[model samples]
Target: MPTEHVLPATGPAKVRTRPVRIGVQIAPQHASYETIRETAAALEDLGVDVLFNWDHFFPLSGAPDGLHFESWTMLAALAEQTARVELGALVNCNSYRNANLQADMARTIDHISAKGGTGRFIFGTGSGWFERDYDEYGYEFGTVGSRLDALAVDMPVIEDRWTHLNPAPTRKIPVLIGGGGEKKTLRIVAQHADIWHSFSDAATLERKLGILAEHARTVGRDVAEIEVSTEIGSRSVAEVEEHHALGATLFTIGITGPDYDVSHVADWLAWRDERNAQGPLAW
Candidate 1:
């Protein structure tokens, strides 16, 4: 029987009030491995805080037959090529690999990143979605609730195995959970995630965050410790402030396709620096 790790009721830490972090998800569905490599290095040179790739077998957009690459393999390579900047999948599917294996893989990459300085590997994951990945990869595609159940079971197993591995991770691997299902998903976020990501608009994000806080209280956890993140399509400085007011300190801007134009990353980097200079806004 799997042991249930009851989360403490203290809630998340007040880290959101710290310096804001800006991240970019390098869409892997439409670029070649070489282009992806160069893009990752360039993003680091441009001073983006974090870089990410998606976990998928085929293209999520564009023509179904368009270029696509595996997530973890590319991440391992990125871990080696880049000297700075954190790296991880924007979200890896929990159902694809065994929990222990996932831990080992993450440990290996953690070592790869720790070569010069501190290791920076954020383990971003979610309950597996996209039926095509399941059918093609030979994994079971169960109901969403079932998948979440599996995630709840596997997360602790991964954490436990990390301790007993031959060489433990140099730094605590931050667990980033992505999704916005109110009941189960938010509950999981309150209980386990160090970071919670959602595709919510500012208004919706504010509303859902309130619910998440309530869930955290119910679970005897601190909501403040969990970093709240959302995707941005536009770079309106005011919109960034609006989300920051809602307690979102980490922001990810996703850029897609054949030409992974990272020109906007410079703008975001500038905005991040400006926000840092201003200090945390009073909400």
Candidate 2:
């Protein structure tokens, strides 16, 4: 892999833009806050394009009960600590906070990351899953369909709140909606997201992208305008290339609790640089 090329903000003149981005999801579980802060900074310095933490009250892997941290508050602090890399919860739980409050918190963090310019905060959201988070946090754990229905209702409210905020957001804060449910999740993505993220294999991604495109037509949105994102860990670089061909430019690797190791990141970073060097159409 080559070291000369870096992620371009846009493709060469006249070509449509498709920047290969790498996002690291640092799970906020089974780790000390001090350690997590240090790791966040290190990942930015190591050239990660984005930093992400899942929205959960407990560990998602390893021992069931373990050291964990809250998503939003930690994001607020991360906003101040990292200067270049974009930051956000991988997918914040929509059921945990009022839609208006969620909007306000994102705006505030967006401001925190912005040093008098467009902020680097990605407003990644989803209808809540992980029933344990809801049960323990006192939120009602509704069925997936109902949760998705609530998300559809809350999205417009969140956008409205953004408009009413005193400072507003530095930029339109790219909203990333995660999940691939055709009935509702993709529909919400069509109506609200600037980014649509999912964790699907090639065949599934192909089918879902088609469904997402149909959703876009219903909402009168052009499917191409929405950036595609997906998560990959324990997968080969060949798989990454396959997903890129399927419209996923943003690839996320999730790290679990306790040992937030990034030893595997170097190869992916090299792959990104090499692939980007071949020109935007190489993927």
Candidate 3:
């Protein structure tokens, strides 16, 4: 059974300009652990700000019964291997583990990276999808809304446990929420997420942001406190500007395979630098 989780509320708002962050989701469902590890190191070397893997039991693409790896174990190894670059799942399934255990695991990984610098572990989470994961793992795969309701209840407990845990995370783990359901999901993002990640083209993203802003206003929080991110399907530099115009500053491109080729990561790094050089927006 999953554990109960909660985050303590604080007063006042801190306004921050969303900075462009580029990340790569190293798809683990189809790659060997060694290949995935090397891919992670390669992505770090290529200057990607964040390195991520999806949490799953079966391959999300290609053969359904292809090579696969466990997410947190790989994350622990990644903490030990990479010298730079933040590490975490693109989003972990909230249904698989107790929230307290998740917090403790994150703390341990944070310590693994603490030798040289503050450990970087972004706690990216979402309610479970893929019925196979539930059936095979003995978890209850309820309705989507029920699962999200569970997540909304559990997030605070996870945050509270982080402080009481013996080691504690080396740094505050940025809470990233994935999904773009305007009514419930985006409202949850507005309430609990430090980062909001979704899949959408520019027009769709623009529409969602407006909905998210309404959710934020309803909750009395500034939507700017949340970093906006989306997955890139094409390598066009113009797409970056299009998403940026819609308030998306963090973009992740996903690569999957037995080979884990990430040559395009370099292009994204260059694009990020170019945008930074252009200075702050006129607004």
Candidate 4:
């Protein structure tokens, strides 16, 4: 089983105040839709807190032309399929769709998942990265700055559209921004995100948190209001503990498809339960 890898402690532990939650990103490539849907159902049954899919037109790894499903449509299907798990893209590319349209789609899915009460949809998004997705789809393949700039402009439009919609979202849709770019990305996260997801290691996360806090302060928003989320792929328990100590409450594992093996998931879930059982602290 792949376990969380231990890394050198960068500094003193920070108190974790939020409940620990486990998330899994089901990479929607190189597998049939039936298999993917089954995997989603299975993971929810295993008690995962969040389910995510990546936004891309093609396989990120393996055969470039392998079988793949689109993120938003698949997410809608998953919303109807699963009852309890919150689901979204790990990071939906903002460049692909119009801002109002994206917001409407998210709102629709939110309603679909609500069933009766609050929605289980989280809108996790980021500035575009993959060039091919843009090239083939004919979106302007602008530079990183341009894409991030576009994202900054579109976020408010999305939020405003949500407010104007006839039936506003069942609940305030949680916005999860995925990136670590200090200048533009983190600033946008401070302004908009309910959750900030990053792939930073312990030391990097600590440093970036400082930057994010500064951005939040400049924006007159409390940094503590944003949840800290980290990708904890194959890292050992001790490493995960170190990240937890640094205040990352949501830990995610990404699994790719074909045959999505989940034998190791129980280990992570056990760790999650253990952390929850113990309550948040600097261990």
TM per prediction: 0.91, 0.93, 0.91, 0.94
Model 2 stretches with alpha carbons more than 4 Å out:
1-16
User: What digit string (tens of lDDT, one per residue) describes model 4 on residues 37-144?
Assistant: 999989999999999999999999999999998999999999999999999999999999999999999999999999898999999999989999999989998999
Tens-digit lDDT string for candidate 2 (30-138)? 8899989988988988899999998999888887898989999999999999899999888999999999999999999999999777798999999988989888879
What is the Cα-based lDDT of residue 91 in candidate 4? 91
Clashes of 4: 5
Instruction: State the TM-score for model 3.
Output: 0.91
Alpha-carbon deviation at 3 in model 3, angstroms: 32
Total backbone collisions for each predicted model: 11, 1, 6, 5
**Ordering by lDDT:** 4, 2, 1, 3
> Which regions of candidate 4 are displaced past 4 Å?
1-15
Instruction: Give model 2's TM-score versus the native structure.
Output: 0.93
Instruction: Write candidate 1's Cα lDDT for 201-222 as tens digits.
Output: 8888888888888999999987
User: For every candidate structure, what is the RMSD over all alpha carbons to the true structure, in angstroms?
Assistant: 5.1, 4.8, 6.1, 4.7
Clashing residue pairs found in predicted model 3? 5-156, 5-157, 5-158, 6-156, 6-157, 7-156
What are the per-residue Cα lDDT tens digits for candidate 3 across 1-283?
0111111125642222446779999888776787887788778878899999999998988899999888999888998898788888988999999988888888888889776679887888999889999999899999999999988888889989998988667788788999988888999999988888978888888888888888999999877678788887774778778877666777998889798778777877888888777755433
Q: Give the winner by lDDT.
A: 4
Worst 10 residues of 3 by lDDT: 1-10
lDDT values of the candidates? 0.83, 0.85, 0.82, 0.89
Ranking by TM-score: 4, 2, 1, 3
Which segments of model 3 are wrong by more than 4 Å? 1-16
Give the winner by lDDT: 1 or 2: 2
